[model samples]
Target: MKSIAVKNIKGRPARSVILVVISMLLTFAIFGGTMVISSLDSGLSALENRLGADIMVVPFEATTQKKFDDIVLQNAPGYFYMDNARVQQVLEREGIAQASEQFFLASASASCCSVAVQIIGYDPETDFTITPWIKKSYSDSLGELDVVVGNDLNAFVGDTISFYGVDCKVAAKLDKTGTGFDTAVFTTKDTIKRLIQSSVDLGMNIFGKVDPENTVSCIMINAAAGFTPEEVVNDINLHVKNVKAIQSKELISGVSDSLGGVSGIIRVLICAVWILGVVILLLAFTMSVNERRKEFAVLRVAGAARSRLAGIVLGEALMICIIGSILGVLLGFAVILPFNGVIEQALGLPFLLPGAGRCAGYALASLLLCTLSGTLAAAVSALRISRIDTGVILRGDN
Candidate 1:
């Protein structure tokens, strides 16, 4: 029975093949876009979860010209300085398990290329968050004046960087972090202090090595196990001075939600591609069925039950769907391959490219759904063939 169906389709397969190709193309484009975006979201969510820190404490007094609350909460670019001594003070508080400090050095233009580096001044000994990633990516070589550049930093490991008139060696290149950190440069607190004291061609006074005293831009706190984040933030806000502690969940969600405009546009474009593909497929299938009315009628007259005839119609559609879907998936990946690096750099994020197993699964799922729809449509159309009077149709037709 299947052989007969195959032979029948082979008689005039152009339209059927075209419909399948169009349907597959649409499904691939829509799902592919969604998958890529979801991968990015997953990577970011993972980073946030792994950090395990309950709150971020940034200097509220750093920006005297502007509102400190607005700068920290709204993500305005500014330098806020808090006494380095507060690191121990925060840790001494009840329910605070540990605390880490970070110094943010703003971006500056260079002679060759313009780039922004978020110089994270971390205590290499105490920073558990980066130590593991750094150890896995590098050995004991990452040191002062030897920086770990983010994957998207647009510079190589051996590249020479002159910031604030202090030259540094790019010790290692990081894998794409898929966050603001990806565009950042990491170093010790003392090194960043020196860089600020020196003057660069841009005339920006970023480092201050003048005084023995120093301040940090922010403090990240890890709550003791079993302590709630809200309780932690409340406790800090009440006891801590000149700084605000924000919960991690709230901060990451705020950033992701703020990207709604960009996400919405991509979703809209995906829907449009799907709609256009379906329209093309529907037209092609309808035309194919019309041209084969005589064939369907003949089958009905030749001891083929209406249900069996319907299955054959659906089978033909399914065959085309499966083939087209496979082709479309291959084509989609081919399209994404060329721009993978640029996409990672521009977005300051890492990409989770689907492996063969994942791609195969996605292709199979897409084909199954499209085939089911095509089968149902063909089944309905085949019913019309059953209603026709075979004698009248056959006799009237040439």
Candidate 2:
């Protein structure tokens, strides 16, 4: 019976090819759409956790807003400085629990440091953010000459990274954060101070006479109990001078909005593709069944049961679905895995693909769905042909 079904499919090569293509398209839409949406959701969640701060404070310059968004949202490497006194001011605000000063230094094009890398200097003694996360891999404090490279960096532990001629050892590498931090280089405030001095000595002078001891690029703050991030941000903005405080939630909300728009478009495209696939499959199957009516009637006359006829039709559909779905899933992964970096860069957002188990689950689900759709498309014709009177069909009656 299965052999008959296979021969029937092979007999109508164009119809079989069309059905397979439709099934493949449906599977591709399901698998690819789910993968992208799932990855974006995971990446955004990781970004929120990795930030670990309620608010970020930066200098109130003309382009500060754009710069902040670039660094945080787009992961663009940048360097901006403000007086260290702003950190103290933020800490003094009501409902503020702790504030850590951070220094930013951009490597010059010809500097020994990695080109265009954002060097972030954190105060280990007062920091409540990056340190705790780093403890997941290394328990000890970061040494003056020791640095933790972001996961995206090319260097590994024990590898020395030169910053303006001062070589700093990579103490450890951070986990992937799916944010700017993943590409950033982190060290103690004291270490950055030395790097600045080295740069000046080497005549790099990227920031020209800026005193690292008195300057900081940003402040990361945590709210005390009974204080909300929004409240802390408002208080800091009101009390602090020459700086801006941004609530983490505000930035996250903006990113979420952008993601929602993109996700909506993807969902719409997936639905359209799925509907078109189903329509094409239905038309192809209908035509195929019409052409095979005489063959089905012959089988009925030969003592083949109606159920057997239906089975043959469904078997052909099942075969097409299985092969097409597997091809589509492989194609989906082939596109997603190799070009993930390019996707992330183009999207300018955090993106983390689903793990192996989740990916397998999605593939299975897609296969099942494609099979069901194919079966339904074939079942309509199967039922119609099965219910017809074999005598009338054989006698050539309309």
Candidate 3:
């Protein structure tokens, strides 16, 4: 039976190839669209985990709200400072479990640093955010003049990075967060203080006189259990001065809204492609079976059962679907893995590919769906042919 199905497929090379190519295209659309959406979802979740803060307190006089939003959501780098006193005040607020001050310093140019990147300074003693993430790579505290570069940065551990004549060793490298952290550099408060002083002494004070000891770029806060982020934000706004408290969810909401539109478009496209593929395959099978009526009649006269005739038709479609889906899945991975960086830049969204096991599972599911659709498209033609009168077909009647 399988041999007969193979012979039938081989008899019409052009039609068979066309059906296979169509199946491949349909599979590609399904797999590619699904993987991209999955990656985006995973990336956003990772960014939330990396932040692990209920609210971010930036100076009230800092850049406009729009610019600040771009910094956190779009990974745009910028620097501003406010009095460190705000950090202490935020900590003393009701429902605040922990708060840490962070300092920001931007390298003037590539000449001033290994790369043009934002420098973030954190207090290890009070930090509850970056420290825990960094501990995954390095357990010890970041010593004086030691830094941890972001995953996107070119520097690696043990490499020395210079900023305005102040050299700091890269003690560790952080994992990618698909956010500004990927392009920023992190170090202890003492290291940033030295960098600021060095810039002043060397007459390269591009950021003006930065009093590292009394200035802070932002404060990260974690709320106590049973206290919501909105409540924490409201409490901070009421009691804290010269700073703005932004909830993490507030920042993520805008991005999520934008993603909703993109996801909708992708789903529509997937559905359209699937429908078109099924229609075309059904027509192809119907035409092919019409031309093979005499052949099916001959087989039936030779003692071949009607069920066997139907199975042969389905077997041909199954073969094409299996081969096409495998090729399509490989093509999807080829395009997605190599050009992921380009895709992320073009989309301007967080993206994290699924691991090997999950990707394999997705591929298997796609293959099964494609095969089922292909088989169903051929089923009507198969059934019609199986019920044809053997005598009329053998007589060459219309």
Stretches of candidate 1 off by over 4 Å are: 1-14, 50-52, 61-79, 85-89, 112-115, 199-203, 206-213, 258-287, 299-308, 337-360, 383-389, 396-398
- Residues 214-308 of candidate 2 have per-residue lDDT tens digits of 88878888889999988888888888888888888787887888878877888899888877787777777778888878889999988899999
Give candidate 1's error at residue 109 in angstroms: 0.4
Ranking by TM-score: 3, 2, 1
Per-candidate TM vs. native?
Answer: 0.79, 0.92, 0.93
Model 3 misses residue 243 by how many Å? 1.0
TM-score of 1: 0.79
Q: Which ranges of candidate 2 are over 4 A from the true structure?
A: 10-14, 62-65, 203-206
- The candidate with the higher lDDT, 1 or 3, is 3
Please, what are the lDDT tens digits per residue for candidate 1 over residues 1-398? 45666886677666656676676777677557765665566555645743446788765555354544333332223455667666556656777777777665655665522454556656675675666676656677466777777766787878878776678888888765455445567776667666555433345744443231466777778888888778888887788776677787776565466445446766898778766666666566666767777877788788888777667766776777667766767676776656755664555443445556766676666666655655555565566655667677678787
What's the ranking of the predictions by lDDT, best on top? 3, 2, 1
